[model samples]
Target: MKRIILSGGGTGGHIYPAVTIARELENVEPVEILFVGTPNGMESRIIPEEGYRFASIPASGLKRKITFENVKILCRTAGSLWKARKILREFKPDVVIGTGGYVCGPILMAAALSHIPTMIQEQNVIPGVTNKILSHVVDRVALGYKEAKARFPVQDKCVYTGNPTRPAIREAKRDESREKLGIRPDDFMVLIAGGSRGARNINNAMLGVHRHFRDTPGLCLYHVTGTRDYGNVLKELGEVDERGYYGSSSRIVDYQHDMPSAMAAADLVIYRAGAVGLAEVAVRGLPSILIPYPYAAEDHQTYNARVFVAAGAAKMIEDKYLTAQELIQDIEELHNHKDVLAGMAEAAEKLGKASAGADIAHMALELAGKKGER
Candidate 1:
C-alpha cells in the first residue's frame, strides 16, 4: 500500500483543503494517510471528526514583532522539527504535502532534507511565509490563484489549482437550499457572515443598516453573527428593532451548521475576503461584496479581493470606508439590477474550479510516480 503524509493547521482554511485532497486520493486506491498538525490548532478537532488518524507536534507560531515569546517559539519550533524528522523516518511516506501554516514549515523542511518528494498548496493570491519558503524546496507548488505564481521563484512548476471546498457547496441545488432555509421563491435573501470567527466591523455595519430595512418588503436578511458576538449583536439589533422581534423576513443565527443551504438560499453574500470564504463564494457562483481584513499578512486579503473584482465577480468595500448605510445602498443597487447580479454570478462561476481536489491529488500522485488510477 502507498503511504502519504499531509501537514497543515491553524485554521479551517488549511485543514479543509488537506482533508478534501485526502478524500479524493482515497477514492483512487487503498492508501495509508497520516496527518500532522499542532496540538491545539483547529485540525485537532476537525481531522479526527473526519475519521482520519492525526498526530500532533508541540509547534507554535513566531510573533511578528520583537518579543521574548519569539525566542521561546523558535526553540519550540526547532524541537518540533526534530520530532517531524522522526515521524518522516517512521512513516516512510512516498510523498508529503504541506497545506500552508506554521505547522507546515517544520514538516516540509524535514521532508526536503530527507529527500522525500514533497508538494505545497498555497491558498491565497499572495503566498503565505511558510509556503513561500517551502516553494523553493518542494517539487511542486499548487496555487489557488494565478496571481500567486509571480510571487514565487519556482514558477515553472506552479499549477493554478483553485481551492477545494465541501462537496455540498459544489453540488448544492438552488431551489432545494432555498426551501430548506425557509426562504420564499421571490424573496431576495442576503447572506451575511464574517468568516468563522465573525467580523466586528461587519456586525456593527449590519446593526446600523437594520433600522432602515426593518420594514422593507420582499427582502430577508440571514446574519450569522459568530457565537462570540451573538449576544452583543442581538442586543444592538434589539435596540434598533425595538420590538425585540425581527419578523420572518430576518434571521440572526449564531452559526449555521449547514452553510451550503445558506449559500444557495442567498441572492447576494456580504463577507470578509478570507481565502476560504472567497473560494466558497466563487464555487457557489454567488455575487459578493467583500471587505478584506486590513491587517492580513502583506495585505494579501486585498490582493485576493482584487482577483474577484478584476473578474467582475464581486465588489470590494475597504474596511475603512465601510458603513451600515453604505452596505445597505450597495445591496440595494445589486438588488435593483438583477442583470448585473446575474452577470457577476456568471463571472464568478467562470473562475470556479470544481475539480481542484482531484487536480492536486493527481499532481501529488504523479510526482510520486504512482499513477495507479484517478
Candidate 2:
C-alpha cells in the first residue's frame, strides 16, 4: 500500500482541508495515512477523533519583526525539523502534503529535503507566510483561489484546485436540509454565522436585523452568535424568549453544528470571509454578504471576499462600516430582486470546486506513483 503523510493545523481552515483530502484519498485507493501536526493545535484532538493515525511535532509561528522571541522560535523550529525528519524516516511515506499553517512548515520542509514528493495547499487569495516559503521547495502548490498564484514566487508549481470541504457540503439536499432545520419551503432562510468563536460585531448587527425582520412573513433569520456572545446578545435583545426566539421568524443559537444543513437551508448568508466558509458557500451556490475580519493576518479575508465580489457571487462590506442598516439594505435588495439573486447564485456555483478533494487526492497518489517509478 502507498503510504502518505498529511500535515496542517492552527485553525479549522487548515485542519478541515487536510481531513477532507485524507478522506478522499482513502476513498480513492488503499493507502496508509498518517497525520502530523503541532501537539498544541486543535488538530491534535480532531485528527484522532476522525480515526486517523496522528503524530505531533513541536511547531510555532515566528514573529514578523526581529525579536528575541523570534530567535527562540527559530531554535524551536530547528528542533521541530529534527523531529519531523525522524518521523518521516520511521514512517517511510511515499508522499507528504501540507494544507497550510506554521505547524506544517517543518514537516513539509523536512519531506522536501528527504527527496519525498511533497505539496502544500493554500486556501486563500493571499498565501500564508508558511505556504509561501514551502512553495519554493514543494513539488506542487494546490491553490484554493486562482488569484493567489501571483503572490507566490514559484508560479509553475501552483495549480488552482480550489478549497476542499466536507463531502456532506456537496451532498446536502436543500429540501431535506430545510426540513431538518424547521424551515418552510417558501421561507427566505437567512443564515448568519461568524466562524466557530462568533464575531461580536456580527452578533451586534444581527440584533437590528432581527428587529427589522421579526414577524416579517415568509422570512426567517437563523443567527449563530457564538458561545461567548450568546448571552450578551440575548440580553441586549430583551424580548427574546427562553428558546432564543426574538420574533415569530427569528431564532438565535450559540453555534450551528449542522452547518452543511444550515447552508443548504439558507437562501442567503451574511458572515465573515474566511476561505473555508467561502468554499462551503460557493459549493451551495449561496449568495453572501461578506464582512471580512479587518484584523486577519495581512487582511487576507478581504482579499478572499474580493474574489467572490469580482466574480459577482457576493457583496463586500468592510467590517469598519458594517452597520445593521447597511446589512439590512443589502439583504432587502437581494430579497426583492429574484433576477439578481439568481445571477449571484449562478456566479457562486461557477466558483465552486466540488471536486477539489478528489483532485488533490489524485494528485497526491500520482506524485507517489511517480516517485515509485523513479
Candidate 3:
C-alpha cells in the first residue's frame, strides 16, 4: 500500500489541483491520501467534501515587507512546522506533495527535514514565494507552466507537467454543450468570464460590447458579470428578458456554474489569466483574449498570460488599457479572420497537456518507490 500526503490551500486554484492529482492517484492504483491545510482555509471545507481525509495546521501568509507582524508570523510558522512534523511522523506517508499556498510551506519544509520524499507543483509562470523557497528542499518540482522553471532557484529538479484541470473540462463535448446552451451550429459563440468574483473592468467594457452586437445575426455573446456586477450590468443594458437576454445576440448571467460546458460551446474566450483557468483553456484548445488581474501576488497573472501570448494561443490586454473599443476590435479581428482564429486554436491544442494529472500522480508514485528502495 502507498501512503501519500497532499498539502495546499487558501484558494480553489491551490486546492483543486491537489484534488485532481488525488483522483488520478486513485485511478492509477489503490492509495491512502491525506490532505493537509490551514483550519480556516478554503481547502478545509473543499478537501473533505471531495471525500479525502483532511488535516489542519496553523498557517498564515507572510507579509512582503519587513514589519512587526512579520515577526509574529515567523513565530506562528515555527509552531506550524512542529505541528506539521507531528502529523508526518504519525501518518508515516511515503511521499508528501505540495501545491502552492502559504499553508504548504511549513508542511513541505517539515517533510523535507524528515528526509521524506517531497515534491511541490508550481501553477504559475511566476513562482509564488512559498514554492520558490520550497524548491530548494523538495526532491522534484512539477511545473504547471514550463516557462516558470527559469523563475525557480533549483531549475534542475523542475519538470514541466502543465496544470491539472477538472476531468469535466476534458470530458465536455462541444456539439452537445452547444445544443444544451441553445446555441446553433452556425452561430459564433463568444464567452466572456472574468474569474468567479468577477472583474468590474470586464463587465464595464462589455456594456458597449452587448450594445454593439445586440441585433447582430449569427453571433452570440454569453457574459458572466459575477454577483457584485450582475444587477448593474443587467440594468445598464436595458430591455432585457427575465433570463438576462438582450436583443437577439446577448445573454448575461451573474455566475457560470457550468464552465466546462460554457468552454465547450465557446468559439472564443475573453478571460482573466488565472493559472487554473488558463489550464482549462489550453486543454480545451480554446483561443483567448487574456486580461490579467493587476493585483495578483508578484504580478503573476500577467506572467501567466505572457506564456499563452508567446505561444500564439492568446492575445493579452492589460487591465489598465482594457476598454470597450479594444475588446470590440479584438473580437472583430478574430471574428472576421477565420484563419487567425484557427491558427490560435491550433497553437493552443499544441500546448495542451491533457495528461498532466496522471503525469504528476505517476511522478509521486515514482518518488514513493525511490524512498522505499533507499
Candidate 4:
C-alpha cells in the first residue's frame, strides 16, 4: 500500500479538503492514509468519522501580539515537532500532504526533515502562514486561486488546482436538489447559512429581518442556523410565526448536514465567505451575498470574498454594515433582479473546478511517482 499522511484541521475549510483528497486517492490506490492534527481541533472528530486513521499532536497557534501565551505556544510547537517526527518514523509515509493550519506546521516540518516528499494545498487567494512556510520545504504547492502564486515565496512550485469541495456539493443537480428540499418550481428560494457553527451576527441580522420575508410574495427562505444558536433562533421564529405570519414560506434548520441539497435548491445563497463555502457555492454555480468574518486570521475571509466579487459571482456585505433591514432590502432587490442573479450564477460556474479533488490527488501521486494499486 502507498502510505500518505495528510495534515490539517481546526475548521471544516482545512479538514474537508484533506478528506476529499483522501477519498479521491482511495479510488486510485490501496492507500494507507493517516491524518495528523491537533487533538482539540475539529479534525480529530471529522477525520476519524470519515473512517481514516488520525494521530494527534500538541499543536496550537501563536498569538500575533506579544504575550506569555504566545511564547508558551511556540515552545509547545517545538516539542510537537519532535512528537510528529516519531509518528512519521513509525508510519513511514511515502508522501505528506498538508492542507493549511497550525497542525500542518509540525507534521510537515517533520516530513520535510525526514526527506519524505511533501505537498501543501493552499485554500485561499492569500496563502496561510502554514502553507507559506511549508512552501520553502515542500516539493509542490497546490493553490485554490491562480493569483495566489504571486503571494507565495515559491511561485515556481505552485499549481492552481482550485479547492477541493465536498463531492455532494460538486455533483449536486439543481432540479433534483430542489425536489429533495421541497422547493416549489416557481418559488424564489433564498438560502441563508452561517456555516457549521453559525455566525452570531448573521443570526441576529436574520432575526431582525425575518418579518420582511414573512410578508414577501412567492419568496421562500431556508435558514440554517448553526447548532450553537439553534435554540435561540427557534424561540425567535416561534414568536414570529405564532400569529400565522410566515404563510408556508420558511424552513428554519439548526444545521443542514445535507448542504448540497440546500445549495442546489436555492435561487440565491447568503453566507459567510469562508474558503470551503466559497468553493462549494462557486462549484454549484449559486450566486451569493457574502458576509465575511472580519476577525478571521489575516482577514482572509474578506480576501476569499473578494475573489468571488471580482469574478462577478458574489456581492459582499461587510459585517460592520450588516443590519436586518439592510439584509432584507438587499435580498429583495436581488430577488427582483433575476437577470443579474442568472448572470452571477453563470460567472460562478465559470470559476468552478468540479474535479479539484481528483486533480490534487493525481498531483500528489505524481509527486510520489506511485502507480495505481487499488
Candidate 5:
C-alpha cells in the first residue's frame, strides 16, 4: 500500500488535476489517499465527492501587491504551516504531492522539511507563485506544458508529464456522445466556452456568429455561457433565433456538467487557453481556436496558446483584437477546409499524452517506496 497526500485547491484548474492524479494512483496501487486544502476552497466540496479523505488548513494566498491583505496572508500562512505539519505527522504519508495552489504550499513545505518525498505539479505555461517557491524544496516538479520548463527555477527537477484529465475524456466515443446530445450526423459541431464563469466577450461575439450562420444547415454551435451571462445570452439568442437567423442549429446552456461528453461530441472547440482545458482537448485530439485571456496572471495563456499554434493543433486570436467577424471567418475557413481540420486534429493527437496520469502516479508510488507494486 502507498500512503499519499495530494495537496491542491482554490480553483478547478488545480483541484481537477489533483483529483485526476488521485484516481490514477488508486488504479495503480492499494493506496490510502488524502487531500489537504483550505476550508473555503473548491476542493472541500470536490474532493469528498470524488470519495477521497480531505483536510483543510488556515492557508491563504499572498497578493502580488504589498498591502494589509498581504500581511494577513503572511500571518495565516505561518499558522497554516504548523497545522499542516501536524496533519502530515499524524497521517504519516510516505509521499506528498501538490498541484499548484496556495494551500499546496504549506503542506508540501511541511512534507519536505519533515524529510518526506515531496513533489508538485504546475498546470500552466507559467508557474504559480506558490509553486515557484515550492519548486526549490520539493523533490520533483511535473508540468502540463513543456514551455513551462523554461520558466521554472530548477530545470533539472522538472518533468514534462502534461496535465492529468478525466478518464472519461480519454475513453469518450464521439459518435455516441453526439447521439446523446441530439446532434445530427452530418452537422459540424462547434463547442464554445470561456472557462467556468464564462467570458462576456465570447458570448457577445458568438451572438454575431449566430446571426451569420443561423441559416446554415449543418453547422451546429453549442455554447456554454457562464451563469452570470446565461439569461441575457438566451434572451438575445431567442430573438435572433426566432428570426430564423440560427435555424435551430445553435444550443445555449448555462453550464455543461459533463464536459468530457461535450468535448467528445464536438468537431471543434473555441476556448480560452487554460493548461487544463488544452490538455483535455488534446487528449481527445480536438482542434481548437484559442483566444488567450489577456488579463490572466503573467499573461501565461498567451504562452500556452502559442505552444499549440506552433504545434499546428490550434489557431490563436488575441482577445483585445478578436472580433465577431474574425470568429465567424475562422469557423467558416475550418469547416470549408476538412483537410486542414483533419491535419490539426492529427497534430493534437500527437501532442496529447493520454498516459500523463499513469506516469505521474507511477512516480508517486516509487517515491512512496512501492517501486515494484504496480
Candidate 6:
C-alpha cells in the first residue's frame, strides 16, 4: 500500500480540503492516509469525525511584527520541526502534502529536508506567506486558481489542479435537495454564509435584507447565521417579524449539516470569498455576490474574489462598502434579469474543476510511484 501524509489546519478552510483530498485518495487506491495536524486546530475534531487516522504535532504561526510573543513563537516553530521530522521517520510516508495553515509549514519543510516528495496546495489567488515560502522546496504546487501562478517563484512546479471539495457536492441533485429542504421553486434560494463563526457585518446587513424581502414571494432565502451570532440574530429577527421570517419556504439557522444539498438547491450565493466555498459554487454553476473579508491575511480574499469577477462568474462587493442597500440592489438586478444570471452561471461552470480531488490524488500517487521506481 502507498503511504501518504496530509498536513494542514488552523481553520476549516485548511482542514476540509485535506479531508477531501484524503477521501479521494482512498476511493480508488490502496493508500494508507494519515492526517498530521495540531490538536488546537479545527482538524483535531473534524478529521476524527470523518473517520481518518489523525496525528497531532506541535506548531503555531509567526507574527509579522517582531515582539516577545513572536520570539516565543519562533522558538516553538524550531521545536516543531524536530517533532515533524521524527513523525516522518516513524511513519515512513511515501509522500507528504500540505494544503495550507501554519501547522503544515514545519511538516512540509521536514519532508523536503528528508528528501521525501512533498507538495503544497494553494487555495487563493494571492499566495499566502506560508505557501509562498514552501513553494520553493516542495516537489509540486497545486493551485485553486490559474491567476495564482504568477505569485509563486517556482513557476514550473505550479499546476492548476483546482480546489477539492466533498464528493457529495458533485452528486447532489437540485430537485431532490430542494424537496428535502421544502424550498419552493419560486423562492430565490439565496445562500448567505460567513463560515461557521459568522460575520457580524454580514449579519447586520441581512437584518435589512429580511425586511426588504419580507413580502416578496418566490424569495427562498436560506441563511446560515453561524453559532457565534445565532442568539442575537434570532432576537433581532423577531423584532422585524413575529414569525421570525421562517416558514416552510424560508429558514435561518446557526448551522446547516447538509451543505452539499444546500449548494445543489441554491440559485445564488452571497458569502465570503473563501476558495473552498467558491469552488463549490463554481462546481454548481451558481452565480454569486462575493463579499470578501477585508481583514484576511494579505487581503487575499479580495484578490480571490476578483478572479471570479474577471470571469463573469461572480460580482465583488468589498466589505468596506457593503450594506443592506447595496446587497438588496444587486440581488434585485440579478433576480430581475434571469438571462444575465444564466450567463454568469455558464461562466462559473466553465471554471469548475469538479474532479479536482481525484486529479490531485492521482498526482500524489504518481510522484510516490516515481520515487519507488528510483
TM-score for each prediction?
Answer: 0.94, 0.98, 0.97, 0.94, 0.95, 0.96
- Cα lDDT for residue 12, model 3? 86
Compared with the true structure, what per-residue lDDT tens digits does model 5 show for residues 226-271?
A: 8899878877867644322346777777888888789999999999
Worst 10 residues of 4 by lDDT: 239-248
Q: For residues 107-207, could you state the per-residue lDDT of candidate 1 as single tens digits?
A: 98898888888899999998998888888888889999999999997798799999877788888888999888777888898999997778889988988
True lDDT of residue 114, candidate 2: 88
Write one digit per residue (lDDT tens) for candidate 3, span 1-374: 89999999998889999999999999999999999999999998998889999999989887879999999999999999999999999999999999989999999999888889999999999999999999999999999988888899999999999999889999999999998888888888999998777899999999999998887998999998899999999788889899778998998989998999999999999999999999999999999999999999989999999989998999999999999999999998999999999999999888889999999999999999888554
Better of 1 and 2 by TM-score: 2
The C-alpha stretches of model 4 lying farther than 4 A from their native spots are: 239-245, 370-374
Q: What is the overall TM-score of model 1 with all chains considered together?
A: 0.94
lDDT of 4 by residue, 185-257 (tens): 8889899998888999998898867766665668888888899997888777675354223447777777787
| Candidate 5 Cα deviation (angstroms), residue 169 | 0.5
| Candidate 3 error regions (>4 Å) | none
In model 6, which runs have C-alpha deviations exceeding 4 angstroms? 239-250, 372-374
Give the best candidate by TM-score: 2
lDDT of each prediction vs. the true structure?
A: 0.87, 0.93, 0.93, 0.87, 0.88, 0.88
> What is the lDDT for 114 in model 6?
88
How many residue pairs in model 2 have overlapping backbones? 0
lDDT of 5: 0.88
TM-score of structure candidate 5 = 0.95
Off by over 4 Å in 5: 240-246, 370-374
**After TM-score superposition, what is the CA distance of residue 157 in candidate 4 from its true location, in Å?**
1.1
Give per-residue lDDT, candidate 5, residue 39. 91
Candidate 6 C-alpha lDDT tens digits along 1-374:
99999999988889899989998899978899889999777889889898988988888877778789998988989999999999999999999999999888999999888889999999999888899999989999999999999999889999999999788998899999999877876677898899988988898898888767875777877888899997888888674244435544347778888988888999899989999999999989999999999999999999889988999999988898989999899889999999999999999998899999999999998888765553
